[model samples]
Target: MFRNFGKRTEKAPDADTVVPLWPQNGSAAEAEPSAEDRKLSAFLELKSRMHEALIERLNLAVIDKVEPEELRREVASLVGDVLAEENNPLRADEFRRLVDELIDEVLGLGPLEPLLADPGVNDILVNGHKTVFVERAGVLEQTGVRFRDEKHLLRIIDKVVSRVGRRVDESNPWVDARLEDGSRVNAIIRPCAIDGPSLSIRKFSRDPLTLEKLVAGYALNAQAAAFLQALVEARMNILISGGTGSGKTTMLNAISASIDPRSRIVTIEDAAELQLQQAHVVRLETRPPNPAGGGAVSQRDLVRNALRMRPDRIIVGEVRGAESFDMLQAMNTGHDGSMTTVHANSARDALGRIEQMVSMIGMELPLPAIRAQIASGLQIIVQLARLADGQRRVVSISELTGLEGDVITMQDIFIFRRLGKAADGSIAGEFIPTGIRPQCTALLEAAGARFDRAMFLPEEA
Candidate 1:
């Protein structure tokens, strides 16, 4: 079922013919390329040639029908024969690395395969073909990974978007897609990018962190974790607010574990990143307009549709635009256990942003009316922040105490007080209760949730 698969006769560059891995565009300010960098660039070039030869020898029509393992063995066999014909001297480890990377080039995300496999790498930021950075343990560090050239980088980006039924080109220069493993990806090319193609991938973890794990990591104290779990068990409407990379999504995933397994849940998102572990759940993702600017489904549309799906809980991955209005309506009408995240600096700011988003729907509603909707719908606002030291912690958990006249009033049930910085540049903070008993305590108790009055008491200094 293959074409004439035989040894490649093309001459390969001698192992000693390594060239400097200078910036392809010849940036003057970049440091002198190192010997190791030169070797890597040479290997990349060699791999590119080998890939072309392999494709020429294989039957492209039936390649997609082959099983992954069988295809890998066939590709490896062909690559080995080609390498032997070229007679380039390589150590066993280097030869194996070359073969593995070739497989990635053929089936995976090319240079990003290794990074995506790294569990510690939480985020991948590709500025262009040559510069790649990864966030490990909440800290950004540059990696030595590089693509062959701009064309190669564009090919990889196209491959990623096409797999998700999306496209990126001059007409549609930007697209949001996800990897097979559900990693969130956003790619923007030429013209709009100014420099070159830019891609950002937020890697999704297979085993999502639970509330117990977050508490162990000191993201929040045990008392606060217990309280949040109780809030979820009570089916309270929760709004998680945080800035970018502040662990808002992680917090949402962890808290969602408390949702009853019997409950019918519906989750909506633009790129579909929420990893809710419930058994009975339907996930809905918004679709961008096609190349002809038709058949686009917005988040607001999914939220409205989810309401009719008879869901016990509606979990919106985020409320960025007019969807916030429909989400609030869902929470107020009947979906009491609904939850969502928002981009904001504080809990109060989160409310203000939601009000603005709701007004954007052009309902022409009064400010107090909007505030009243928010006050009745949302019960808890959990604020998260990533400290300067790269520690993400819940800064506060405030409860909506209903609107006092036209103003929506809230009381902080728990807070993290930043005492000072340590000598090692680490942040020193205390997760302390604000000693305010939330108005929802009765509601939680009525729902048979464990309510600990002592956990809400302020600590004695």
Candidate 2:
């Protein structure tokens, strides 16, 4: 279940009004003005006037060329001088705050800078310009942030997409991009988005969570962590299966950290997000097609090219298309420790998804043969799930024990058994071993990785 990281208390702003900006250390009366207060209206009007003047005085071309700190200083001085000439009613600190926000509107992601700065916030969702929601500790809450209008939201969206060398016009009204800090961003506008411009941002933490942190957070038991580390060290192919926001990529990153530093690893993704610390890692990202509908570099192409690069391991961020076939081939052909994530409800469904993906390539391979390739290439599947209470945990760890007749056989080595919900609505569960030792334990032993057999023994056993 979700751990309470202490709720962040913020006053929700009015949708129709622009909230007056004040310094953090300003007087409580000035900082927390009520909506009905005449002073609040005056402050907002002054901000609007000052903002326009600052924009006009600013050199847009030079702003992009100068350092951010330098630009901030220059803009601050300009705003201060303009406020003096206009006989601004606000205090010096209030003027400074207004200047900083105006600079953000010009040089940064307008209303999103504050949300992005909040370490507690994990996601920022903008439903047009008038509404914004954020995910904090797996719970969605409406934030007081908003753009001026739909046009303001569209401008921000264009700024994000264009920075990534992508476009989103009437013809292509949807785009996926990454922020400078690796946050995943998706935006849709106009024709596709009937409800004005919509933007969703999945924020990545500056400090990535490690396996130890995950175990401490009860995302998985210590035994399962040790088992995964052993699997990586023994060069076993692994498939991580989870639904959206189930912590699949986080788990993949944590597990991949166990990989040997000397081995060269290649990672492919639509948008590069993995933070693998291995020195020999090669990162590749897919590119969207140009306006001419050409020059697109797909994940499948990257996977194929990774093979010729002589990688010891291949890690695809997620297999969503025909790339599954190429990734499987890489895993089968000597890339023993390769790993990938899949969007699936369970381990069995993950395999089924892979079969469907491979078939999409038009290979016309028999179902049995496809199952065989999957069973042989993948040694384990670690399934993750975000519970009703917003806690992400490893739901199952299944071993791919090869094909039995026409179907692939999998045995669960570890599983999270849900007991019930606690008084706080958090899901209560215990992770326990199934007592059946994985067939790959022999392979792990043969590869010089020692694991305790007692780890496989169930509590009753």
Best by TM-score: 1
Name the 10 consecutive residues with the lowest summed lDDT in model 1. 1-10
Candidate 2 residue-wise lDDT at 121: 94
lDDT of 2 by residue, 302-372 (tens): 99999999899999999999999999888888889999999999998998999999999996999988988
lDDT of 1 at 307: 84
* Candidate 2: residue pairs that collide: none
**Native-referenced Cα lDDT, model 2:** 0.87
Per-model C-alpha lDDT, please?
0.89, 0.87
Kindly give the number of clashing pairs for every candidate.
Answer: 0, 0
lDDT for predicted candidate 1 compared with the true structure: 0.89
Residue-level lDDT of model 1, residues 23-43, one tens digit each, is 335564456787878888899
